[model samples]
Target chain A: MSCNIAIAGVTGAVGQEFLRILEERDFPFSSVKMLASARSHGKKLTFKGREYTVEEMTDKSFDGVDIALFSAGGSRSREFADAVKKAGAVMVDNSSAFRMDPDTPLVVPEVNPEAIKDHKGIIANPNCSTIIALVPIWPLHNANPVKRMVVSTYQAASGAGQAAMDELALQSKDILAGREARCEAFPYQIAFNLFCHNSDLKPNGYNEEEMKMVNETRKIFSCPDIAITCTCVRVPVMRAHSESINLEFDSPITADEVRELLSTAPGVTVLDDRENNRFPMPIDADGKDDVYVGHIRQDESIPDNRGINLWVCGDQIRKGAALNAVQIAERLV
Target chain B: MSCNIAIAGVTGAVGQEFLRILEERDFPFSSVKMLASARSHGKKLTFKGREYTVEEMTDKSFDGVDIALFSAGGSRSREFADAVKKAGAVMVDNSSAFRMDPDTPLVVPEVNPEAIKDHKGIIANPNCSTIIALVPIWPLHNANPVKRMVVSTYQAASGAGQAAMDELALQSKDILAGREARCEAFPYQIAFNLFCHNSDLKPNGYNEEEMKMVNETRKIFSCPDIAITCTCVRVPVMRAHSESINLEFDSPITADEVRELLSTAPGVTVLDDRENNRFPMPIDADGKDDVYVGHIRQDESIPDNRGINLWVCGDQIRKGAALNAVQIAERLV
Candidate 1:
C-alpha cells in the first residue's frame, strides 16, 4: 500500500529540505499534504513537478494520512501532536517536545530502528548536533561499547533556523562592507566571531543544543549508563555542523579497527587521510545525506588502547534534520 | 640601561601585529629596527609615527639588539635566530621551530613567565589555539590542578598566516559573487566551512596545532601527568580562535570557585553571563590584550564533580603571539 504522507511546518529550511529530499530519495507516497503556519496557508510549493497547496496545520490535517512528519517548534507540537495522533496517523516528530518523554520512542533508524515499534503513535527525531555526533558514535559504541563521551561541536548557524542563516549572510556582508553588523537572531556579532549561547540556557550551564546531544544519544543508543558531556558553539559555516568527539570505551580499540567499523556503518563515511589533508569538511558535506568522519585516532590521553578521537561533519539540514526524518518515513512501511 | 628591539619577518601578520601592540602597550623600546627576507627588504614600515626601512635579515642585523622578536616561518628562524642570539639579543620567537626543543624556553607569560630566564637566546610562544585554551585552563589548573584535557577548537584563518586571512576575505567575496572560490591558501573553500586538518600531521594522529597544545601546556604547567587530546580545526573566523575545553581536575571544583580563581588570573577576564547572553566572543576579544573566558560549568560526565567545561576566545595575533612574546621579553629583565 502506498503511504499517504503529511509534512507539518513545511516552510522552514529543514522543512524545504525535507520536501526536496523526500522527492529526491523517491519515498513511496500515494499523496502528500503540506502544512505550515496560518500565514503560509494556500501558498503553493512544487515537488517533483507537482504543485501542492500548504494548509494551516489543524486538528483535522492528519486525517487519512498514514505517516505525519512534524518539524514545527516544540510549542506547536505540544499543542497539536496529540490531535495528530488521534487522527489515526503515526507521527515522526522533529521537535524536543516528546523526545525525553518516557512514553515516546526516539529513533535513529540506523542506530535504533526497533525503537519505532514501541512508539505510542509518535516517534521523535534527535537534535541536529546530536545526530551528527551519533552517526560516528553509534558505530564506535557498537564495536567497543562506549562508557562515556565528551563531544565539543563547532555547529553552523543554520541550526538556529532559517533566519539565523539569513542573519549570518547579512552580517557577513555587513562586516565585509565596513558596516556595523546589527544582530537580531543572535546575541553577538556573528561575522568573525561565535557565541556558545543558543535559545535555551539552563541553570545547569548546558545550552539546549548540548543537553539534547547528551540526552538524545542515551535514548537513541538505549544505553542509560553511558556518560556524555558536550559544549556546542555556532561557527561561521552556513550549512554543516562538525563535532570533535572523545570516547572512552569499555575495551581497547585501534583507530584502524574503528575506521573499518565505520566503513560499513550506515549513514557514516570515513574521510581520514591526514597526510593529504583529506577530512570531513562542511564545504564538501553541504547537501549530502551521509555523515562524514575523519581525524580518527586512538585517544592518547586515555589508555590509547581504550580511547578514541574522531571528527565528524554533516549538513545539519540533511542528516541532522530532513534526511533522518525521511529515513524514518521510509522505514514506516 | 635601555633596550634596542629588532623585529624579524617585519611584513607578516604576527610581525605587523607585534609592531602595533608594542607601540600601543608602550613596550619600553629605546630603538626599533625592522628585518625581513630579501623579498620584503626595502619595504617601508611605520612604527609609533616613525617610518623604518626594512632590511634583509642577515647575520649582522642583530648586532646591538637587546631583544629581537621573530615571527618568520620555521626555516628563517632556524637560520637567523641563532645569529640573532650570537649578536647578544634575547630572542622572543613566535615560530614552531624552537617550541619543542628541550633547550628552548617556550613561554606564555601568564602560565610560564619564569621559563624566560632559562632561554638560551630564543624564547618560544605557544601555538594560538594552545594559548587560548591555556588562558582559561591555567587559572583553574592553578586553583584545582587539571589532570587531563579534551579540546576541540574553532580557530580563525589568521592562524595559518596573513595570506590565509586575505584568502578567506577574497574567497568569501568570490563565493558570494557566484564565482568559484580561490583556494591557494587552503585545500578547500574557507568562506563558509571548516576543515579539521591543520599543517603537519604526526604519526600519533594529532595535527601540529594539537600537538603543540599537548606539549606546551606540560612545559608551561610543569605537569607531565596532565594529558590532552585535541582536534584543531581551521574555521572561517577572521581574527580570533575559540576553544571548547573539557578539563578534568584532581579535586572537585565548583563553577563558583572557578569564577573567583579566574577573575583575578594574570591574563584572563571573566565574561560569564548566561542570563543576558553576555560571554566571550571573538569579535569582542579582537584587539584585546587578555584572553576572554566564559560559559564555565561543571561537567556532568565525570564522577566526583572533577570535570569543568569552559569556552575561551583570544586574538591569536595578540595574546596568542605578539603580546605573549612581549610579556616574555619583559620577564627577561
Candidate 2:
C-alpha cells in the first residue's frame, strides 16, 4: 500500500520545493493532492510528470490523505491542523504555529527520527536556520557534549517566502540598471545589501528570528540546559543559509576528531579543504540536501582545546524546511 | 607652507578615494602629485576640480614631497618606502609590507595617534578589516581590558581593487540576464556569491587577511599577549566592510556600559536601535568616516555578562586605508 499525500500551499516557495523533493525521492504515492489559498486556486502544478490542478484549501481538503505537508503560514496551520487530523491524516507542518507545542513533535529526521513516532497526528518542522545549524552540531554533540554555542547566521531571502525572493531578483536588476531598488517584501533594499533580521525584537534585544533559533534548538535537542546565543542577519543570497558556529565543549575535541565524527554522520558533507582555501559557500549549498561543513579549526582565542569553530551552509528551502518535512513523513511510513 | 603630497597608485580604487577624502576634508596642500604604475602614466585624475596627469612612479617622485601616501601593493611599498624616506618625505604606507615591522609604527590615529610621534620615517596603515574592527574595540578595551576577541568579517569588493568591483557589476548583470557569470579577479563568481578572502592561506589555516587582523591588531594595540582569532569572507558589496565581533572580558560588563563607552569614543557612531531594528549596515557606512557600531548585546551563552557582541561597518577606503594614512600625514604636519 502506498501513501496518499497532499501538499498545502503548493504554490509557494517551500511548497514548490516539496513537490520537487517528493518527485526526486520517487516517494511512494497512490494519489497526490495540491492545495493552496483561494488566490492560487485553479493553478496547475506538475508532480512526477503528472499535471495536477491546485485546489483551494478548506476544512474538507485532507479527506483520504495519509500525510499532508503544510507550508502555509502559522494562522493557516492553526486553522486547518485539526481538520487534517480529523480526516485521519498526519500533518507534517512547516509553520511555526505548532512547533513549540509540547504535544506536537518537532522533528529533524537526521537528528531525531524517533521523535516522529511520538507525534499525535501532527509533527512540526524546526525553523530553517535551526535545522541547518543542528544537522552538523547534533553529530558533534553526540561525540562531545557542548557546553555553549555561539552562532551568527548569514541567512538568505527565501526564509521570508517567495515574494521576498522575487524582491531580491527585481531589486538587484533595478539597482544594476541604475534605478532605485524598490523595497517591498523587506524593509530595505535586499540587492547587494544586508541587514539584521527583520523579525520583531524581543525585550532582551534579540530579534524573533534569533530567538527562534535559541528556543528551537533546545526543543529538538531535548536539552533545555544548553547555553545558546545567536545573531541572525539577512544577507542577499537567494536560497541557502550559512552559519558561523563557535562550539565550546566540556571536554577537549580536536578538529580531526570533529571531522571524523561528521564524516560518518548522516546528511553532512565535509568541505574543510584548508590547503585550497575552500570552505562551504551558500552558492555551493544552494540546491543540495546535505549540510556543507567546513572551516573546522581550533578557536585560538580560547587556549583550551575545548573550543572549536566551523562554517555551515545548507539550502534553507530544501533541507531546512521542505525536504526535512518529507523525510519525517517517510519515517512515519 | 602647506604640505606637498604625492599619492602613489593614484588611479586605483583606494587612490581615487584618497583624492575624494582630501577634497572633502579641505586638506591643506602646497602641491598634489598623482602617481601610478607606468601603464597608468598618461591617465588624468581630477582633484578639487583640477585635473592632474598620473605620473609613472619612480625614485624621483618623492623629491620635494613632504608626505608620500603609498597604496600600490606591498612590493611597491617595499621598493619605494626607503627612497621616499631618504628623499626627506614621510611615507604613510598603506601596504602590508611595513605594518608588522617593529620600528615602523602601525597607526590607527584614533586608537594610537601617540604612536605616530615615534614613526622613524614610515608610518604603516593597518589593514582595512583590522582598522574597522579596532575603532570600537579599542575604546571598549580601554574601559575594560578585553581578554579575547573573535571576529568574522563580511568584506566588500573594494578591498580587492577597481577591477574586482567592475567585475561584480558585470557578473551581476550577466547573471540577471540568464547568462553565465564570468569569474576573474576572484576564484569564484562574486556577483551573487561570497568566498573566503582570496589571500593566500597560511600554514596555520588562516588566510593572509585573517592574519593581518590578528597580527596588526596586536602591534597597534600594544597588547601582543591578547588572544585573537578572525575569519574574513568577501561578500558582494561594492564598498565598506562589516564585522561581527565577540569580546570576552576579564570581568562582567553590561551592554548598557558598552553603549555608554562607545557613545563618547572617537571615530565611533552608535546606531544601536533595538526598537526599530536599526543597526549598522555597509550601505549606511559607505563613504562615512566614523565606524558605525551597533547590534550591541550581551552574549547570553556566556552568563554573568562576560561576553558582549557587536556589529561594525566602515568605509574600507576611507577610515580603513586612505583616510587613515592621510591622518598620519596630518600628524606629520
Candidate 3:
C-alpha cells in the first residue's frame, strides 16, 4: 500500500509543514523526493530522522513519484501539473491554481472524502481559512441546512508564510524597544495591529481569500445556492486563525443542538464553557490538529431562532494547510 | 460662553483623555476642577499648562461646577449622579450606569445631538464601540435607513483602562524574552493573542460588550426596530478599536453612494483606497478624533444589492469616550 512521495517546494512555510505532518501521521511512503526551486537545490532537509538533499523540480522530476504533494505557489503548481499527470503521479495541490477547475475536485478529507475518488490525477486543496471553517460547519450543515453565513476572520501570520511569522516576532521586539517596526512580509505593521486581508481585490469588492471561502464551501458541500459573505482580516497572532461566524439555517436550531452535534463530529473539539467564560482562542489552537469550536449561541437578532453564532479557531499551518493535504493523500493509499 | 468644568475620575485613562481633548479643542472654561477618589486625592494633573490638584469627590465637590464630566466606574458615577444634579451641573457621564435610564439621553454627538437637548441633567456617552460604529453608520442611515446590521469588533486594551494597556506592553516584553505573559488585567494572555470580550456573559450568550453595541445603537439611533448582532473580541492593539460591519438597508444602496454621503460627514474620515489596498487600520486611527471608515463595498451575497460592508476604526479612548463626551459638553455651552 506504500507509495513514493514527492514534496515540491520543501523550503517554504507550508512545504516545511508538509514534511512535519507526513512524518507525524506516519504515512506509509516507500520514498520521499524533496523537490524545490533552483534556489533551494542542493539544500538539505531532515525527514523522519533521515537527511535528504533538495533537488530542483523540472519536467522530468516526477518520473516515478506515485504521489506528488505540491505546496509551491500557484504558478508552479500550474506549470508542473501536466508533467505530474503524464508521469502517472497523483498531484495533491495546495494552491489556488486548480481549485475552481470543474474537473479537479477540491477536497477537505473531513468534509468531502468522497470527492477524492473523482479526482482526475490532480486534486486541489481548499484555502486555509475555508478548510478551517468547513471542518466544523459541515457536520452542522448535514443536520439542518445552512441558508446564509456571515463571517469575519481573525487570521494569523502563518497564513502569509514563515517570513511573515518571523516579521511579527521581529516587529514585536523592535516596537517594544521603542524602534520602528520593519514591514517586509506585510504592507502594514502586524505587531499589535491588524488590517484587512492582503489579497487581490475582485471586481465585486470581495478579496480572493474571502471568495475562496464562498466558492470552495459550495463546491465542497455540494450546495451552490447557500448565500455567504465574509470579511477577512489579518491579526497579530502568529500561528492559528480564529473566526466569528453567524449562520442562518433553513429551520430553527439551538446552541445546545450545535454543541450536541459537534461534540462527536470528526476533527472538531467543542471547547465551549459558558460559565467560566472560556471559548475558542488562537493560543488554544496553536499546534492542535482539531478545529476548536465554541461560543455557540442562538443569534438573538433573529426572532425566529433560526440563526446561530460560533467562534472557531484552528492551526493555520496544521489543520488549515499541511495536515489537510496529508489527509487527502492518505485516502489515495 | 465660558462655564466651570469638573472632570471626575481624573486619574483614569478616559479621564486623562478628557483633559487632552479639552485642551486640544480649546474648550472654553472659566474654571477647571480635577476630582477623583480618595486614592487619587492630592495627585497633580496639568491641564492647559496649569497644574491642578485632584480632590476627593464628595457631595459638595460639584458645588460651583456648571458641567461635570464623569469617566469613573459605573458605581462611582451612580454614587455621584445625584450630587452633580443637585448642584445644578449637567453630568456628561461616560459609564453605562445611566445610559439606558428613562430620563437620561444616551448621546453620540455626531449621531444624535438633538438627544442632548432632552437630557434631564444627565447626558450619557454611549459605549466606545457603539460610538465609533454609529458615527459612520448614522450618515449612511440618514440617507437610507439601515434595517439590519451584523458586526464583529476588534477592540483594543485601552477600553479596559490604563493598567490594561500597560499590561499589554509588559506582556509583549515578557513573551519576547521567552517568559510567560502575566495575566492580571486580562483573563488570558493578550500580547499576541485575543479572546472573547471579558464582559460578563448575558443569558442570551452575548457578552455585555456585544449587547452594549446592540442596545446603545438602538437608543442613539432612535430606531428600536433596527435589528443588530455583534461579536466583540479584545485584541492586543494599544488604543483604537476596529469593526467589520455589514448593513442591509431598506432599499438598494451602492458603495459609491455611501462613500459620497460620508465624505463630508462630520467626525468621519473616509480612508478607502482599493487600488492601493490601503483601508483603515488601527494605527491610522490611533489618537485621532475622527472615526476612520474604509473598505466600503457592496456585499456580494445579496443579489439585489441592499447590503453594504464597511471596515471602521476609531480611537477607543478619544472618539469612543472622552472626545464624544466633550462634544456633548460643547453643545451645552
Candidate 4:
C-alpha cells in the first residue's frame, strides 16, 4: 500500500529537495500533494514521472494526506501546523518554528531515529550546519559521550534558498566579467569572498545560522548541558556545507577507536589519512548522499582524549535537508 | 636621527607588505637594504620613489642595520638568525622558526608592548590567525585571564603567500573562461570553495597552523598552561583572516563587559551592534591596521560564565603579518 504524502512549502529550496529525494528513493507513495504560499499557487512540479500542481496552503492543506513534510518559514508552520495534524497527516517540519519545542522531536535519522516515533505530528529537520556536523559527530558521541563542542562552519549560498544561490551565480559572473558584483538576497556581494555575517542578525550578537547550530545541537543530542558554540560563515561554495568540529568527550577517544566507531556508523564515511594528502572537501561531497569526514584525531592541545577534531562535508540541500526528511518518512510505514 | 632598516625575504608576500607599510607609515630611515635568496639578488624594487635592489642574504646582511625584519621561510632564520643578531640588529622574524624558542620574545605590539623590553635579539611574530584571534581575545584575556580557548579560522589566500594569491586570481580567471582550474599552489581550487585541511599536517593530526595558534598565544601572553585548540580553513577571501573564538575563563563574562574591554584595547576596534546588523567583516578590515572584533556575548549554553563567544577579523597581510612586524619594529627602538 503506497502512502499518501504531502509536502508543505513545496516551492522552497529544502521542500524541493524533499520531493527530489522522495522520488529518487522510490518512496512508497500512492499520491502526492504540493502546497506552497498563495504566491506560488498554480506552480507545477514533477516527481516520479508524475506532475503535481502547487496549491495554496491553508489550514486544510493537509486534509486526507497521510504524511506532510514542511520546509516553509517558521511563521507559516506556527500558523497552520495544528491544522495539518488535525487533518490526520503526520508533519515533518524543516523550519526552526518547532525544532526546540519540548513536544517536538527534532530528528536526524542517523543520530536520533527513535525520536521520530514520538513526534506529535511533526519531526524537525536540523539546521544544515548542525546536520552536517552531527553526521561525523554523533557516532563518536555515541561511542564516547561528547561533553562539549566548538564548531565553525563554512556554509554555502544555497542554504539561503534559490535566490541566494542566484545571487552567488550572478555575482560570480559579474566579478569574472571585471564588474562590481551586485548585492541582493545577501547583505554583501557573493563573489570570491566570505563573511561570518548572515542575512539576518539576531539580538544576542549571534547570527540566526549560528544560533540554530547551538540550539538544534542540544535538541538532537538530548544533552541540554552540552557546551556548544559556533561561528557560522557563508563561503562562496555553491552547494555543500563544511564544518570543522572539535569535540570534548567525557570518555577516552583514540583515532583508531573513533575510526572504528565511524566505520560502523550509518551515515558517516571516513576520508582521513594525511600521508597521501587525502581528506574530504566540499567539492568531493557535493551531489553525494553521505557525509564525508576526515582529519580525525585527538587535539593534543586539548590535554586528553577530550578533544576530537574532525571535518565534515555534505550537500546541505540533500542530506542536511531533503534526504533526511525523506528517510524519516520511510520510517513511518 | 633615522632608523637603519634591513628586510629579509624582500621578494615574498609579507616582505612586500612590510615594504609598503614602511613607505605608507613614513618610517624614518637613514639607510634601507633589501635581502632575499640568491635567486632574487639583482631584483630592484621601487618603494616610495626610492630604488632598492635586492641583495643576497648572508651573515653580513644585518651589518650596521638597526632593525631587521625577517619573512623568509623558517629554515633561513633557523640557520642565520643568530648571526644577524650578532651583527647588532633587532631581528623581527615572521617565521615558525623562532616563535617557540625560549630566548626570543613574541610580540604583537598592541597586545604585549611591554614585552618588547625583554627581547634578547630576535622578536617572533605570531601566526596570522593567532594574531587575529588574540587581537580581540587579549583584551578580554586582560580583563580576566582566559583559562581556555577554542578557535576556528576562516583564513584568506594571501596568508599562503603571493603565489597562492596569484593562483587564486589565475584559477578564478580560468574558471570564468570555461577552463578547468589548474591548481598548482594549493591542493584544491580556492575560487569558490573552502579547504578544511592545512598544508602542515602533523603526526598528531593537528596542522602546523593550528599548533602555531596554540603555542604562539601561550608564548605571547606568557601563560604556558592556557588551553587552546584551533582548526584552520582556507577560504576564498583575498586578504583578511577571520576567527571565531570561544573563550572560557575562571570568572563571569558579560556582553557589556566584553564591549567595554574591547572598546579600550589598543589594537581592537569594536564594530558590534546587533540591532542594526553591524559587525566586522573582511571587506571592511582589509588594508586596515587594527583588528576588528564583534558579536561578543556570554555563551549561556555552557556552565557558568565559562563560555564567551566572539568574532574577529583583520588583514592577514597587515595586522597578521607585515604591519604587525612593523609595529614590533617601532617598539624595539
* Every candidate's lDDT: 0.86, 0.90, 0.94, 0.84
Largest TM-score belongs to which candidate? 3
Q: What would you estimate as the lDDT of candidate 1?
A: 0.86
* DockQ value of candidate 4: 0.55
lDDT of 2 by residue, A56-87 (tens): 99999999999999999999999998899999
For candidate 3, give fnat to 2 decimals.
0.67
Model 1 chain B, TM? 0.97
What DockQ does every candidate get?
0.81, 0.69, 0.79, 0.55
* Decoy 2 TM-score against native: 0.98
Off by over 4 Å in 2: none
DockQ of 2: 0.69
Task: Give the winner by DockQ.
Answer: 1
Residue by residue across A47-166, what tens digits does model 1's lDDT show?
Answer: 999898999999989889989888988898888877878988888889989999989988888888888888888889988988888887887887779998999888888887899988
Model 4 chain B is weakest, by summed lDDT over 10 consecutive residues, at: B192-201
RMSD values for the candidates in order, in angstroms, are 1.3, 1.4, 1.0, 2.5
TM-score of each: 0.98, 0.98, 0.99, 0.93
Cα lDDT tens digits for candidate 3, A285-326: 998999999999888787788999999999998989889999
Clashes of each: 0, 0, 0, 0
Higher-scoring candidate on lDDT, 2 or 4: 2
